[model samples]
Target chain A: MKAFTVEQGIVAPMDRANIDTDMIIPKQFLKSIKRTGFGPNLFDELRYLDVGQPGMDNSKRPLNESFVLNQPRYQGASVLLARENFGCGSSREHAPWALDDYGFRAVIAPSFADIFYNNCFKNGLLPIVLDDAIVDQLFSEVAATEGYQLTVDLSEQVVVTPGEERFAFEVDAFRKHCLLNGLDDIGLTLQEADKIKNYEQQRKAVTPWLFADV
Target chain B: MGKTLYDKLWDAHVVDTRDDGTSLLYIDRQLLHEVTSPQAFEGLRIAGRKPWRIAANLATPDHNVPTSAAERTQGINGIADPVSKIQVQTLDDNCNEFGVMQFAMGDQRQGIVHVVGPEQGATLPGMTVVCGDSHTATHGAFAALAHGIGTSEVEHVLATQCLLQRKMKNMLVQVNGKVGPGITGKDIVLHVIGVIGTAGGNGCAIEFAGEAIRDLSMEGRMSVCNMAIEAGARVGLVAVDEKTIDYLKDRPFAPKAEQWQQAVDYWRTLVSDADAQFDKVVEINASDIEPQVSWGTSPEMVVPVSGKVPALAQAKSDVQRKDWQRAYEYMGLAPEQSIESIQLDRVFIGSCTNSRIEDIRAAAAVAKGRKVASSVKQAMVVPGSGLVKAQAEAEGLHEVLLEAGFEWREPGCSMCLAMNADRLGAGEHCASTSNRNFEGRQGFGGRTHLVSPAMAAAAAIAGHFVDVRTMVEEA
Candidate 1:
């Protein structure tokens, strides 16, 4: 995985709130646990009127021309600007996988659900929490200027606008370090292998019954 | 130096602290299910490593497991979906290969792993429980510090008995006064979510306490804690009480007599002091809560059953307005329609959230003599566990349900999710007692309105989503 400091990316604003994980990637696409293939199918239900069928008429498909994702200006967008309470509902990690796979390097929102926010950092996606006014400003700027690009510097923890309107956001130092290094919870745990091994030895001696095979 | 239940549990499980201040917390029990475990099991096989503590870990095939026993008995080849069959079979094979105990398809112990763990005493008080399921916080009713982990973290826990972790900030949520009649644990959680909003509890471990919480039964407490994730809390807990002790006694994995007494003594000390400190605190009067039902897609968008759907223009914030519009469009609900007047196509009363024996008994009490309305498509009663199902059947609750025209099904995650054949057809709406009400949560284009089991039963009889209080009063 290539880790970038997120220098600059176009912000495609999605004005809807409570945009759930299922909407990000529906249940039918959840058949495969492999994280890579899900990006293309993200929002398949909303994008296509009839999914998973051959020779289906696309002429009658409900084309949501107003949707930020479907707009030609936001095509190949790397930064997603969403409203508050984004990524609610299920804790499926596929939501972040789809976001990352769709080439979104960072997500700027007023708030995010606890599980989805945590899942984002682990999957090499940055979820930045900004003030409501700041979020509104970002949305307005994106609406006014097509394909607006904002630079996010992980080293400085600041999001800089096109006009150099920079706002600093706070993230846990450890989590920031993990995201910078592309280390997940498991990768971090594996770094302490010696300590884990020693604990296992001591625990085995104390509770021998637990070590026995069925 | 008074210790909250969280403090005692965290202290007991701390194996060591590294130089960076991260604790190597030893997990006493590791629970696994079908969805998150397959990838972790694959990681283990690729690395050629067995479970570090095989006896301490347990696996169950839920989530993707077919609730219908007949379908399950027909084997993997008999299933319509090849992927679900593969997922279940992989879990079965992994458990056998690793010599870990598994509650498989036909096993009586099989259920939602979160439900099965506590009911069987595999989740003990003061133990650090880790599961590859987000609702693992359901085990916190027993005073266990249970939390969910990711797939890679599951692999780490299997190879090493410890998990690398950062500590959460503490928050005390005190629900005071007595709960009014007709309100259940599901209502309490929904009301709490509404008060706190979805993101209010972020970065904190919430302790549900005070008189109202203390009065709840073990199952009721589990239901309350189960939805903590819905409110953005990392962990939700309740102190061990007599109800907890009583529930744990005689279970297969519980401590023996002498050890049990000692364990209870330790549990008694797990309560917070009168002046215990918390980083954040929220107080709610239980009496103020009503029969809450979700009007919008998110849990936090719920209101009292007597309330009407909210208009987007009346929403307090722009985001709220947009969310209201989106939810309204997807749910096919009018902003001014009375929530109680909305007709229901189906009623699903099961899942880890509200599928306990008490939940069934509560629902059956409402459906005893009443007949389900003909307009209702299907009203199904699925117990959380086979043990619960058997117990309910012995009490003639199943007969009462069938007599009332509700389909009785075997235990699994039936209809709470669209997985399996138990699903609502296109454009169908349901009165579900499950935790989430997101669009297509039940099936593609299937609308869900979360309510209490009693409320669900009443809806089944009335053939529309209505308050159970009215039914109780009429009876």
Candidate 2:
């Protein structure tokens, strides 16, 4: 996993709310458990009108002109702005994989479901929670401008807009430390290896049956 | 000080408190399934470790197992899908290597891990159960502190007989009084979600209490607790009662004679005290609740069947209004349509959430001697487990379902969330007893309306949503 700090990227705004994991990547694309190759199918049902077929010529298809994703200006966007209660259903880890594969390094939303938010961190996608007012400002600014860009400084905990508009966001101290260091939940657990080993040894002595069959 | 059932269960499981304010908790039972176990077993192998408590762990294959016999062997073989096949093979190998008990494909005990664990008596009161599947909270019906964990956490629990975690604040949700004649446990849960919204119980462990809960059968209690995640609870529990004890007696894992008396004595203490304090308390009167059906994508978008579909402007918050608008556009539902009058193209009566024998019988009772509507293309009834299937067949529920044009299939998670081949075609609307009604939850672009099994059956016969009580009265 690469651990480079994200600095600046063009913004891609998804205006819809309650965009579920199923829509992020439909169940048909989930045939392979391997986490790769899902990025192309991300929003498969929405991006294509015909099932199992990509947008015909990427031009003749009935383009959902209103969809921020279908807009030409947001191509190669790395930052995603979304509404509240995003990623609302099923604990499919593929949702994050699709986002990451689609080249989105960070997601800024008013709020997110617990499971999907946690899964995003594991997959190296930074999900920044902001107040609703800040989210509304970002959405308006991006919608008004032709090509909007935001620079996220992880080391400084700041988001800088195109005209040097700087906004600060708060992250849990521990989670920030983990994100900066690119450590996951397993990595955090492994940090206490000596303590875990000692506990195991002590536990084995008390409950011999636990280790007897092993 | 009085203690709620949540506190009692938490206190019993805590081994020690670490310096960082997290607790070292001992797990009484660890359930495993094929989908999430392969990676964890690979992690264990890489670390050169063995399970600390082999006897406390049980494994089963459910997700990838095909519901039809023709596809079963073909599905299990190293097919084009190498990852799923590897997952199944890894479980088979790991259980044999570790000497842990397993319920493989074709095994009578093989089903959804949550369903199999309880049906086999592996889940008992006061036991802290951990499973890799999120629906593990279904086991909380036995008064156990059951919750799901991620793959890495699964490895940690296997390596050590304990888990590192923080305690949750307690919430008591009391639904008192008797349910109206037609309301089922599924309706009660959907109603609760409707009232509380989807994110109502975040970061809380909910203890479902009061006379209404105590009166439900064990199967009904499981149905209610299974969807607790839909309301954002980490866990949902009911107090141990005589019904709980009766369900656990003489099963494979239940303690024998002498130990049984001691276990029962211990289990009796799992209930809450009369004056138990909770951080939050929400009460609902069961008599006022009606049979519920989801009109939108999220579980919280449900309303009583007697009510009209909610307009976006009627939503309480801006976010809620946006959600309502999005659901309206996606579902093609008008704001003023009565929930009772919406037409349905299909009805599904199976899932980990509501596929037990009781659920099947409930649907069958409504479908008996009544043909499904000509406009309804497909109506399916898939049982949760082989045991449930056999029992329902022995009771002639299968014949009734078939006679009524419902496709009775083998036990598995069929059309619940579309993990299997059974699915709703695009743009189709269905009355489902499954936990979720999210966009394409049953199939891509398929609109789902959540309802009880009897309601699903009734809707199938009527070609639209209908009250089951009216059909019951006519019958």
Question: Using DockQ as the measure, which candidate wins?
Answer: 1
In terms of lDDT, the best-performing candidate is 1
Tens-digit per-residue lDDT, A1-214, candidate 1: 3465765878888887777787887766555645576666667667665553212354566656766777899888898988887887666777888888888999999888776887777778889999999999988899999878999999799999999999999877766777787664554566677876676678566443233332
* Deviation in Å, model 2, residue B246 alpha carbon: 1.6
Per-candidate DockQ values are 0.37, 0.26
- Stretches > 4 Å off in candidate 2: A1-7, A52-66, A154-158, A162-170, A184-214, B14-25, B45-55, B73-100, B159-164
Q: How close is candidate 1 to the true structure, as a TM-score?
A: 0.93
For each candidate in the order shown, give its overall lDDT on alpha carbons: 0.81, 0.79
lDDT of 2 by residue, B190-287 (tens): 99889877777766788888788888899889988888878777688999999999999987777676667877887888898998889988999999
Candidate 2 chain A, which ten residues in sequence have the lowest lDDT sum? A205-214
Judge the docking of candidate 1 as incorrect, acceptable, medium or high: acceptable
